[model samples]
Target: MASPLLRKPSLVHEGDATIVHQLLAQDTGLEYVGFKMIDLKVKARYEETLTDQECCIVALTGRITVSEGEHHFTGIGTRESVFEKKPTDSVFVSGGKQFLLEAVTNATVALCYAPSLQQLPTRWIKAGDVGVERRGKYQNQRMVHNILPDSDPSASSLLVVEVYTEGGHFSSYPPHKHDQDRLPEESFLEETYYHEVEPHTGFVFQRVYTDNRSLDETMSVEHRDVVLVPAGYHPVGVPDGYTSYYLNVMAGPKRIWKFHNDPDHEWILARQ
Candidate 1:
């Protein structure tokens, strides 16, 4: 049986726009996070008014312009593909704002959302502003790009990031979980993973499981697939000859992120 947490891409036509995947928190039994990936052709525009959620618009590929009220941000993206290993541009839109996205070239954009009542400024995040880090070691190595981390304070509840794992490598490893809301210890965050594989035909494996073994499922994820992490420790492993890339969106009652690694696997961190 197919796991409910594994979401495959389905095209939905919205007037001139084609949404590759649209997921709401309610759809996944989550509380705060929601996601959408839109495909736009050259000169095509998509308009929306965010009534109760703040959004982070991430340009996955090609170039696009975002306009809100009198503010216009033009030519905001650069990379032609997610595998390019370069930081991409993103824009943060506050709640109750009306925004427009127009493609200067054929583009794919990701929208990461979280519920909010605060009306903050709509800010443009340039590609240069993104913080890139190389995380883990040996087989657990991966590249991380922090787009809208909790420390930024620009967002009320959403935390967005991009990760790249090489072939035969592991990511989100040591099997960490943030399902508890024990302040200063662990937080309760619901997350979504939008995955894309290099070469388009390859696949990766992701396991979402709890310590009690009650909610355990391993998924073979392909390009454009999404994995929902409602609760539990989630980790990703890429098979040999296939590189992996994923956009992560997370949200919870609080904006901070504190995680606990599985005690059984935490010993791996001691290895040089």
Candidate 2:
């Protein structure tokens, strides 16, 4: 079950004094996934030492240099904003290591974290290096960028991905759920959505609910709003004339991303 903190979203704004805005803390009824958004001003920096969690530093805009132990990764971004419709770069660092980032230009970075004991080598994933799949059809059509997919065995529990939908289109459709431990058919997982809408003034709708109706919420979301999922079938929709983009951080007992679609919407997949 999700705590009240998980049910309510604490938005991080660019003008805020805090450099790091954490969406899920230890008290948020989450065991695996932890999320944060960091903004760095020119010549400014952010640093952390991950003793229990591994993380992926995904660039939302500008360029930054990431230092992990003896290795350094530079020029880690290009797009001016997520609305630019271009895939950005990301750097992954293992647990038990010191992570440092400095902004060469003003930048915003999404931090996806998951608890783990294993340590993987720090690696960079460029925009061109990620696979892009156009999913759904008509208004349901959207783009999916597979990052840290199950195909890679380096990380123990984190699964990262990004989704973008055109104006008036629906994404995260079919209302899928991975809250149970039913393997092969479904996997138990916790997820968090960090959102950004194009034109800055745009908005989206996200619904989190359980089958027995024990938990349910349909939220009106704006730029930089976050949604946390502890156990539920989640779906998202965007209004007309506005594009939608969200970075998803997921973790669970298993690294696989098998989900159960709502039975009512399961038939829609057959039509596609």
Candidate 3:
């Protein structure tokens, strides 16, 4: 069984405009990966110095000017909203550098991190450069956008991807788990799910469990919620009339993301 860990949206009025929500990390009981959401207004600036960890900044909405060392990216995102269904832009910077982002407009960004010493050159990933795939079928069908897939030679130990599911749909289906480092079957990876639901007020559901049913847990996931998957067969379901989106941040001893499906539910793949 798997015990799901969820963090609800931070309590802040619209007028207050939250700055950052630290979701998980070494200090917070997570060892490999860390996640956060950065919200800024026009001309607002945020800066951070990353040590011994590589980071990826994903724009959720609006545009921002990114400055890291001598590299600069202006207008980092073109999407007006997450529901735009358009591919968005993101930046990846190696550790031991300072990250500075100035909001060109009101914006929301996701920050993902993991330990690493290799200083890969920074890059601006265009929307079209991201590989996209329509996966599954029926209600389990979803779109997957690969950002920092393993094939990326510049990456050290981070794998980033985002999934979108239509309303009344299921994602991460068949209850897959990558808690073991056994190759050809599964490779251990620590992951974090940062969710954003269309309608903003709508919610989603997630089930994280293990084979023994000892750590089973189902959680009601609202907008801005973050779920930590230390080890489990995790799956998600979205309610009707509200689309679902989640950014996945992963890191592990091995950079590979091989996973194993629950044997009882693996047969569903044939139908898809």
lDDT score, candidate 1, position 112: 93
lDDT of 3: 0.85
TM-score of each: 0.98, 0.92, 0.93
Tens-digit per-residue lDDT, 1-272, candidate 1: 89999999999887667999999866677789999999999898999899899999999999999999988999889799999999999999999999999999999999999987587888998889899999999999999999999889888888999999999999999999999999899999999999999989999999999999999999999999999999999999999998999999999999989999999899999997
Give the TM-score (vs. native) of candidate 2.
0.92
Which pairs of residues have clashing backbones in candidate 3? 1-210, 1-215, 2-209, 2-210, 2-215
Please provide, for model 2 over 1-272, each residue's C-alpha lDDT reduced to its tens digit, 9 standing for 90 to 100: 44352333444454321345585566566899998888877767788888888898898788989888787888689787887777888888888888888888888888899877586888887778888889888778999888788787768888999899888877878888999898898999999888888877878888889999898888877788778888899889999888889999999988989989899887877874
Better of 2 and 3 by lDDT: 3
lDDT tens per residue, model 3, 91-176:
99889989888899999988889877587899888888989999888889899989888887667888999899999899999789
Each prediction's RMSD over C-alphas, in Å, is 0.9, 2.8, 2.6
Worst 10 residues of 1 by lDDT: 24-33
Order of candidate numbers by lDDT, starting with the best: 1, 3, 2
Better of 2 and 3 by TM-score: 3
Off by over 4 Å in 2: 1-17
Clashes per candidate, residues 3 or more apart or on different chains: 0, 0, 5
Candidate 1: segments with Cα more than 4 A from true spot: none
Evaluate model 3: give its TM-score: 0.93
Descending-TM-score candidate ranking: 1, 3, 2
